[model samples]
Target: MTQHADVVVVGGGQAGLAAGYHLRRQGLDFMILDADTAPGGAWQHMWESLHLFSPAEHSSLPGRLMPAQPGETYPDAGHVVDYLTDYEKRYGLPVQHGTRVGAVRRDAGGLLVEADTGIWLAKAVISATGTWSRPFLPAVPGRSVFTGRQLHTVNYCSPADFAGQRVVVVGGGNSGAQIAADLALDGNAHVTWVTQRPPRFLPDDIDGRALFDVAAARRRALDAGRTDTGGLASLGDIVAVPPVRAARDAGLLTAKPMFSRLTASGVRWDDGSRAGADAIVWCTGFRPALSHLAPLNLRGPRGHIPTDGTRALGEARLHLLGYGDWTGPASATLIGVGRPARDAAREIAQLS
Candidate 1:
């Protein structure tokens, strides 16, 4: 027989973990279903050499300090996994790992979730799968004819992995910028990054300290519909700078505007330019994965759920975390996910 609970959260990343914590604390029956073997979804999948821009103190979760070692810059990818693992052991949070959700449906009474492992019925479901599951790669012309290995930055593990090849990286976001910097410093390959528009880089002293406060503040505003950023502006694209320009000044790399087509042995630009390289890395952005949630009535076009005026997802009974520029402050931070989670749990409690 299928297990029943008061709530069932999909995805086991920070959002899901905090949601689970809130539900349990409120004495609500709930379980987390995760696709990975453990928590820390994308963090665990980061390129092996990555270190978070935010320091560990800023990366802390609901009730735990990520780590408080001075002189320790933000954590490497491994540190993220370690932290999440500790979070599991720390709280003994009940999570079912490696369980692929099949679908989520609503009946007269409540939500029913089906997964590869089994079926679960709950009063509500929290969709915490942030916008990274499906990496959006543009349909470049002649892409199939390219006679080189092509990979997304999402799959990149380290600079050493591309030690001896000419790499063409597409996209100007944080990921592409950092990857280009890494490959150039190692003297491993000729790195050419492509982004239509260059970003504004700030001074080192600026610190760009946004991890905690932004996450915390946005959570309350997003849920209450009183976010100060106003309408769609609240969810505008957010970019954080972390000393990326220093790499640009070094002669090892240069960024070009993106081209529209791919050739058998090189890339072609829209301005009628041509760049030949041994490999191509697409650094395109991400979108949320909620195709499995069609039955749940959770989303509209482009994967945005029909939340109540962008404040709450549908009602207070359900809450969306880490969506829309991570604008709902508390919902976005490692330390802040709890506030919204707690509020969501409280709202759920009022439901039954």
Candidate 2:
């Protein structure tokens, strides 16, 4: 039997929930299909020590402000999970948990959303599946020959797992900085942090809120047909969160240039310097999880579904939300996703 809805939202993460909030306001009948068995989306899987660079109040969805975690300046992953769980219930969003969507294709009537649980025919489809599941591990030479344990940001849980081992942390982003700091602060691992370029840290005062403002300003400029202002890229790469700041000041978080290639036991640099390692943690980031939409054959040269605002150019009835700024400025962040979600919902409603 095919379920029917005006809109079928894939992925019950922050992006999906934000879209749900707006869809409800538009009085559109919709169903959210979540791959996870529980609420909290990807936040549930983040490392135990992971903390948001912004405080709870500043990191939130469209309708509700995230409650401040008692005695914590920046709330951890667990706190975010709790907030997302609560937010979903508070809005009474109709989410079908554990229903993993397999593919999205055009239907004679509308769009067909084939999932493990069932098939949904919806007038519009919102692909809000964020990138957590698609961790990207770059192909460095000799990577396959390395005998040491290798993991990506998604597999990381705690520094204790790698304690007393020589671990190499790769990538220049926030995850790389935080994980390296976590290992160093644990005081048990011999940690070497490496990046393609020298790690750039945002000013100590900068946080998610500041980054969002910069993104918004850039968006306004772009809308006004002004020159591109670089947006968040104008700011440095890493946010100097408390843990990272402490680790940097203590010289425990210094990043070396990325290694030239992996050795059987560890890695080697262009300078011929070699380091032995028990494990390598790749925080190289992720590609958009858009495999479900492959049947559409809509990807452009950059491997992105070309879009005007949130609406897909290849398929007008489809909206791509929360992949990144290409969909909307700062659309991937907690606070930043709201505007894009609202705009997407509004557009869907208008089209309906």
Candidate 3:
């Protein structure tokens, strides 16, 4: 049986919820299809010690502000999960859980969303599936032959599992910094943190709120046809969240230059230095989770579907939300998703 809606949203995460909130306000008939069996989206899968870079007040979706957690200035992953769970219910967003979309193709009526549960045809489709499930591990030479246990950010949960092991964490981003700090603070693993270059840390006082503001400023500049004002990239890479700061201040989170290759026992550097390891955690980051849109044949050489704002250039009826800045400035973050989501909803309403 074909399920028909005026619009179909492919995710129920922060981005999808933001889209649904605006869509509801616009009086558009839409349904959000979430692959996860429960709410919280990717937050539920984050490492046990992970915390948001901003306070709860600064990290929120549209219509509802995330309530501050008791005793936590920067809410943890579990708190985020609770917030998202409540956000959906409070707004009564129509979210169908456990519906994994396999592909999206053009249909006679509109776009066909083929999911495990059923099919949906809609005049407009919003693909908000963020990158959690598709962790990207760089193809370092001999990675396949390494004997040590290897895992990506998606597969990691707790630092306890790697206790007392020699662990090498690769990547310069937030995940790598956090995971390395988590393990080091646990005082169990001997951690070797490596990045392609020296890890850059944002000022200790800066957090997600500041980053979002910078992105917003850059977006405004671009819209006015002004010279490109640097966004988050102008600031450093890693945010100095409490734990990361503590670990770095204590000299436990020092990062080495990236190793050249993997060895049978561990990793080897270009300078002939080698370290043995019991496990390797690849915090290399993720690609946008857009495999379901493959049938559309719109992805370019960079694996991104070109877009004007959130609307796909190749498919006007489709909008790709919350992948990153290309979709909107900071659209991937909780607080940042609202504006782009609102714009997408407004555009979809006009099309309908």
lDDT per residue for candidate 2 within 1-352, as digits (tens), equals 9989999999999999999999999999999999999999899999988999899999999989999999999999999999999999999999999999999999899899999988999999999999999999998999999999999999999987997899999999999999999999999999999999999999999999899999999999999999999877778899999999999999998889999999999999999999999999999999999999998888986678999999999999999999998899899989989999999999999884
lDDT of each: 0.72, 0.94, 0.94
List candidate 3 segments past 4 Å from native. none
Candidates' RMSD to native: 3.4, 0.8, 0.9
- Superposed by TM-score, candidate 2 places the C-alpha of residue 323 at a distance from the truth, in angstroms, of 0.7
Q: Compose the digit string of candidate 1's lDDT tens values, residues 1-352.
A: 7889888888888888887777888898889898888677778888765777677877777788888545557667788778888887788888999998978877666878899999988888787877667788888898899998898877887777777787898876678777777787777787888876754443343332543444445555766788464432233222333335457666544667778889988899878888888889888888767766777565666667766422345544455666544424535456656666776777778786
Better model by TM-score: candidate 1 vs candidate 2: 2
Model 1: which ten-residue window has the lowest total lDDT?
231-240
Error of 2 at 209 (Å): 0.7
The Cα RMSD in angstroms, rounded to one decimal, for candidate 1 relative to the true structure is 3.4
Report the C-alpha lDDT of model 3 over 106-159, residue by residue, as the tens digit: 998999999999999999999999999898988899998999899998888887
For candidate 2, the lDDT comes to: 0.94
C-alpha displacement of 223 in model 1, angstroms?
A: 9.1
